[model samples]
Target: MVNITVPQNSPSSSSHYKSSPEGLPSPSPPATIKPSGSGLVKDYWIRSTTCTASSTADPKRKRQLKVDIPVVSYGHSGWLTSSSLTTVVEDPWKEVEVDGDGFSVYCKKGARDVMEDRFKSFVDFNGQHKQAFFGVFDGHGGSKAAEFAAENLYKNILTEVEKMGEVNIIKAIKQGYMNTDSQFLDLNNRGGSCCLTAIIRDRNLVVSNAGDCRAVVSNGGTAMPLTSDHRPSRQDEKQRIESLGGYVDYSRGVPRVLGLLAVSRGIGDQSLKQWITAEPESNFFKIVPEFEFLIMASDGLWDKVSNQEAIDLARSFCVGNDKLQPALACKKLVELSVSRGSVDDASVMIVQLGQFC
Candidate 1:
């Protein structure tokens, strides 16, 4: 364990970081806002200072779907797993139930590859929020970044949410991403990880993405993309990079920041922090009755499968006595991608929205 303790911060904690004039833009309330205090949301308490208020903020694969963006080419000489003299532990691919009843999850580490992916799904997590919290972190270079993110991202987001007392989902989620990136940078961790998280509360489905890992929702069997993959080749992404005086290099079919990291936004990669950002693009929508299911996975699955195809396979499993076994459907998705030659760690979390009361 990397001793995942919450780093203490004071409102005037200059020692924590040398201030930047652009010192992380203050987080803005999510695009859509609903007045707080609905019967569905339970009030939660948070210490006033657990998280300092400062800024707000806040892929894949395969084939050539309508989106022509290239999948990451696996060449990471520029990045290292960990600089410490310790051997990184490898986790095997096995389906485990992290949460149940309201949701089902299935996750596996890639074969022969130190599992760089981590996931979480909790209904009424930590006795607060009284809603489902889910996420998938895809790590490159090492599992440290992914592990760290899995351990802390939710806490940070919740802290922000608690600060707002569930007043704003978007800002809380955005600050969560920013806080995770800042905390990781304090360790000067050399690797980076992509993040995709979905917070379901008040009948609202809010999703935020910081890299290529993805979140998709099935509305009446129609596949709807919830977050945009943050890749350098996207015209807007390239513009953002160039504007920051950071350029993207395409020596490989994929674009890399400074010819190094593949994704345009992520949790760490301190070296490319200036060019790449940890801020996320989030989408918030009222979960309609048509919302049947949601699938979030690392690029390993996304690279070889299309959004609609993945949803179709999931729907196929919704038959017979196994109708509620979404975890099995998740494992099947991973198997299908590996069969198709996915070359990275595969992880998937399936949320049967209809199952939620």
Candidate 2:
């Protein structure tokens, strides 16, 4: 009989998910067959070609002629079954505010998600500046890179702005980006990249794009791109890549470098570190009250969904619900992207007036 003993801490110990009853008897093993008498006798006999009459007469050879045979037995056992109960903890979403912009930011990391691509609304500088800043740092590679930008970019911008003053917001933005990149390189040994777009003092929207992630601004019910998507196919990007000793190849009529990655700009990627540097091209826009909303999303959502589709969806939710919040609208966009078969990590942030407070 086969006797199987399970440890107390085994998976089957859980009463809720276990299949077997308590203290059940083990199952029996398969029976083995014994050889017949003649076959067993033949198995012990030895036959050798070199045996001679003179050798047979030797006492040692005669004494050792009786061979001892060993019998081995084996049996089969049934399969063992077990069960386990797993407990998963869900993360919570929270709302954060940025002073008096009448805007509130709500952020949540979704199911099986690791990256957080949210932002804090701009804070005033020494209580003297009237500018309200808001930004979305879309991260690629990992959340650490994005988190690094989201936490430090604004502070870096503020510091650069203090030295350069209002005359050089673009320059300051660039300098701040470089500073942040250097800091990331120092801390992580590798850095992550981000697409940064900030609304400063509620009057200017400054954007710095590095990767394929995008920032779009909705104006008067029309979608307008606030920043260009930095892809490897772009002429300037291709030239920059090759200039930095990287090669671009055409595979199956599609232009690709190393036949895999698509983006032109990113942090880390130390393998392509020569091609990647932290010099950001800054574009500044004068914000008017006419600006309806700003939508920022990772490539996962943008790759599968159109800009207009996202805008329409967000607008629909905003118009239908009298008290619709922009952050909630952003969440809805993420949900829609998932429903549309976007298997990649998806994140979206929407900024609109009157709903942020």
Candidate 3:
């Protein structure tokens, strides 16, 4: 028997609606029997030979680009399941650790063959001091949506800000999200990304989230969650999807939309566009002395680590030190999540709020 455990609502998290349990239809599994776990050496040999022969047969096709980064075997392993075999190949382009002017970021791939998580940070955006944009995007299905958003979401937001000015920051942000979503759909890309973004301008803090990615701020040693996870299990989100002619399914361990996508809101997912919206929940705050630092991460870390637990650990690494080491702190959080059995790609960023204040 499979006992699926869902994340409990946190005190710092807010939801406008309550959930009522009900039965739902489960989708039929694929008829193909996928290879499970590490397979027989013979099977790998057969597949390799077949691929080599096929490539040789089609010599006119362009060769795939070869990456030259050295592979580190440590912490990277392949796992096997009853229905499929998963491998983890280290990506050299991914930012394992980075230290910016006032922020630090860390990322690590999980058991998946490709790391679907992406992040972006721009300090002194638009050539202005104390103005910045930070984001963590968790991609599902593929990395295209995540990559596109990481590169263009802030740009779109900046464009909107330029048109609307400071007074309409919230409206500008909402428009920015919709514009990004529409632009991505126009590209005819598949998959989707859940994202959390924080913008600092004129000493004011604006935070937004469209999926499970989260933003938490440390206020005088207390952990404050600024964004709520937009899962299908969430009452308001489930109801919203149903009202729009979408149904939430409970099969496959967790509540999912049509038993396919897990999150109810995201940037792309053109196929599920009708059911999934890119509307992000946003909040505003005035930077104050009480606010110490901010933490933004994908659901990968949140799935295994609690907001308070992460904040407590970060405080030990970032606060009261002769020199700040937020990059190391971010790494530690990702490591902690992995140790706690998180198999999802984790990306974490820590921003020192006091610097902006």
Candidate 4:
């Protein structure tokens, strides 16, 4: 194996990308850094820098390759913290939560030096008092893909609905995912993101997911999953990849696409576009009294907490004649996930269905 040195940046360094007058931040540094390794080393750090190859085996003889590290500055409150209405410094080891009317969101960074998870919550969407949207994006490789999706996905859906007039809500959502993926690809960005989104319009609830992020609703305290994770371990996904000339390797104790990414479908990931997809699995349900609340979260929680256990705990804090602190429920869940040895970023949002139903 070729040894490579990665330049590390402090967390506070993200502040260097402050927003410009156009509401977009300055571009990231060009990828003209020194070349350090062999062919494999060139591919490992493709996200932030480019590498050049030499026919000789000498590292000193390799020519340096230059590229641009795609900058995702729009709609970012910071590198780690995200809130639709307000900004808060995010701390993985401490409570970082946001409370809104009938909804609350909590996000905690993982063991990684940088948090890659981003979320969105929009209420009174497009002048419609009853319309709302919520989403959670779990990013891997880099945060650019997740931040891009969180900023543009729902807006794309809204644009489609305005043109199509909601003739088919599901169709609009699908288009949104497609547009977001295509646009991010044009940026030539590395990495990808798993997304879970919930859209509430009138008395209808539409849920969609492209990766491991999940959505669960409580029907009278019963947990009902809305999306199935897209992993290579699934028989159908494995078959699909094999049919497309790709293979899943389980040698690392997790099924990965070509022994790389564990997720089979996500936004961005241009290198693995042939094997993975951005197409989301979507479902619809009519809001009813039986539906008590909805939970949208990243795999950080699911890796350690069972669905029923999460539901039961959330119910204790929220389900009653007089609801307790829904925000507290969100905090408790994230705390539990971290306490259970989850070193991944945990983000959870609790939406009380009674307000919409």
Candidate 5:
């Protein structure tokens, strides 16, 4: 384990993490702001010391400036309080012409000191109001696998789409996964697998699985899973791995690969990659505009909570006043997972489609 210590700044100290302009107040107010909807609230706290000030003249004394105001902002801090959830209205797809077709994303890293997990990207092409959304990478063995997927999977898929054309989306998705896996192998000896699912042209969704991470779409309040869980215990996966010269170890009847890894497929774990395959197992579904919501989460979440349980929790929140359903759902999922004793790092992304979109 690598120890990374972040230096703490004293409230009175003038370090970069807590520096303000001369004459400005040190330490700014927390970033936590209430959500616009009723009974829904979101909050964030940032530790910093950059403040802005304004002066006003006293009513009785025309020549006297009697009021002093200080506003502070900082870039970094030691111990900051942040809500487990975040929602953004920005265009992850960066489509300008499409009015209401932009992407909405919500993310939360549950209960961990650091957010090592990553999320899929939703991007909109300039002319395509149809939209493209992807839940493409699930990191395992370490954060590197997840981070790499979050950062590059969308771009890789887009590139593949461009080269192969939309008629061959399945081919494009498969090639993209294989290419991404190879890239990870080349960059770092340690690699991870990804389970990718995407909504294309706002009509169909394609799912590709390589690891245990799961993607599920809520249809009329019922949970419909979009991808399969690729575990070594699965008969077909075990046969494939064995055919590739890989052996499964069963210690006390609990099966594991090499007695350490559990999943049958992944992008990294170079030592295991040779035995493990990167070829994605895929499925496709036509999306109904009336679909309630979509949930993508890491293994930490699924390990502790059932798909139906997560779906019910998200459905419960959907009826409330929270307009930021995605973020709220993610927060609730994380909380529930922690409550159920999920010690590993947990991350989730919820995407909700409005009727207008």
Candidate 6:
């Protein structure tokens, strides 16, 4: 299991949601599955592989670009089974320890769906290699999906990376996202979640994302988006959904697929399975010398704050006094988003790439 710094929810995380006894569906597993300490991994081996799109030069027009992001087959409705109890984290802001300058993470519960956003950060050890993993999940209807992904997604990524012998890191990240989604779906979960994950290995930073939760890096004082947001209203996403026989409708002044979920890609959502997917878009880059810091958050923060604004605020605070304080930066950003009016569940993480002082 990945060692993640989970955010302790406010008063609502425990009281607002249904318990595992109430949430767990039919076909409950045998008593033997639950051991003395080990949780869900004892009996289950999750499997998943997400698709990747590539950009190639057009045959006829040499300068033109051709994109190809493949999609894996999905037919695992039979695997749907039971889910574990809900996971909770205390404290809204704190420092998650890591080896040699690890990043800082901060989160704030929103008004919708029992503080649906969740995150995880840790170094992987159960694999052939060691890599730092950080993920942020935004749940739409409930916290179950987000919680499950946070607990199990990093492990799956480590598994896939080991399976491939680390030949292709991008493929492994994609597969990790899909595999986690599969595990959540198998539990017969109701809500879907937007996910953004960043993996650091040997000074390389790889970002993978499904749905709108995002990652932004400070490159030479400019906010550079590592993963693009996948909202249903986007032309490409709308076209893809329409091709799948799914239509996008406007409600509450926001475009949604079939007038339902706002994001086009995510985990769970059995009803929107045909259109919404777990496939993730990945970006690969080295943690160059120009890299200053990284800010990752849900749409609640992005909706109110731009990439530059967030970078400026965090950088200014990181170097304000005697020493760097990424934790403080994350806290300030979350507060700013709320002050600017973000009604959704707000979550933010600041990764200090290098010391500014």
The lDDT leader among the candidates is 3
Candidate 4 lDDT, tens digit per residue, 1-357? 112121111111111112111122222222112212332122232111101111112357454333222222112122332212111222222234555556777777676555667887766556566677888998777667788888789889888887777868788888889999999999977677888899887888989999888787887887777777787777889999999999988534667788777788989877789987998888888888888899898888877777777889999888884747777788899889878777777889898877765
Candidate 2 per-residue lDDT over residues 1-357, each given as its tens digit? 111121111111001101211121232121112223332213322110000010012376443232212222111121122221121112111112111233323333433234334454443433434545555655444455666776676678778988999788888878887787778777744335555555445465666666655666666666666766565566887898888788666544445444434555655444455666667766777666556777766665576567777777777655446665565566677667667655455556565543321
lDDT values of the candidates?
Answer: 0.63, 0.50, 0.70, 0.68, 0.53, 0.64
In model 1, the Cα lDDT at residue 277 comes to 87
Deviation from native of the Cα of residue 74 in model 2, angstroms? 74
lDDT of 4: 0.68
How far is 65's C-alpha from truth in model 5 (Å)?
Answer: 35
lDDT of 4 at 336: 93
Clashing residue pairs in candidate 4 are none
Q: Is candidate 1 or candidate 5 better by TM-score?
A: 1
lDDT tens digits by residue: candidate 5, 116-186? 34555443431355465556354454445666665556567768988999888888878877887778888
Pairs that collide in candidate 3 are: 37-80
Model 2 residue pairs with clashes:
102-357, 103-356, 104-356, 122-133, 131-201, 132-201, 132-202, 191-268, 193-267
Q: Across residues 116-198, which tens digit of lDDT does each residue of candidate 6 receive? A: 66777654323213456678888766666777887778778878887886668789878988998888888887777889888
How high is each candidate's TM-score?
0.72, 0.64, 0.76, 0.75, 0.66, 0.71
Q: What is the lDDT of residue 297 in candidate 4?
A: 86
Which model is ahead, 2 or 3, in terms of TM-score? 3
What's the number of clashes in each of the models? Answer: 8, 9, 1, 0, 14, 7
Q: lDDT value for candidate 6?
A: 0.64
The better candidate by lDDT, 3 or 6, is: 3
On TM-score, the candidate that comes out on top is: 3
Tell me the lDDT of candidate 5.
0.53
